[model samples]
Target: MKTYLQAFDLWEIVNVGIEPPMLRPNPTLAQMRQHNEECAKKTQGDVLPTKQCFRHDLYKNHGL
Candidate 1:
């Protein structure tokens, strides 16, 4: 058998309507290619599967 005591806490019951900031809009195809090139240069490695893949990864990470 289990016995429990119940207490009400306003803070716990309240819903704080906090909204997350808007994400940056999707980048154009050209911007994506440029970003890929920049990333490749920064990493000092060639981009595989074309620049689009790199941009896709970046966009996903940034929540775009």
Candidate 2:
């Protein structure tokens, strides 16, 4: 058995009804792609795919 206690429940704090600033409202395809690319670049400092990094391994396993 486990027991846990929280300092405050969800109702204890206030939350705004409007969307947070980080969220986008119906972005265009280009806008969405740019946002995704930014996030990917942020994660690794540079964005790269495993396929581009390990071509020999791909050819050995799948001949692709």
Prediction-by-prediction clash tally: 0, 0
- RMSD values for the candidates in order, in angstroms, are 21.6, 14.1
Q: How does each model score on lDDT? A: 0.43, 0.43
TM for every model, in the order presented, reads 0.30, 0.34
Give the lowest summed-lDDT range of ten residues in model 1: 1-10
Tens digit of lDDT per residue, candidate 1, span 2-40?
A: 011001112212334433233358978887676555534
Which 10 residues in a row give candidate 2 its minimum summed lDDT? 1-10
For candidate 1, the per-residue lDDT at 27 reads: 73
For model 2 the TM-score comes to 0.34
Where is model 2 more than 4 Å wrong at Cα? Answer: 1-21, 46-64
Candidate 1 lDDT score relative to the true structure: 0.43
The sequence of per-residue lDDT tens digits that candidate 2 reaches over residues 9-60 is 1211233244322537888899877765554443342224433557778778
Q: What alpha-carbon RMSD in Å does predicted model 2 have with respect to the real structure?
A: 14.1
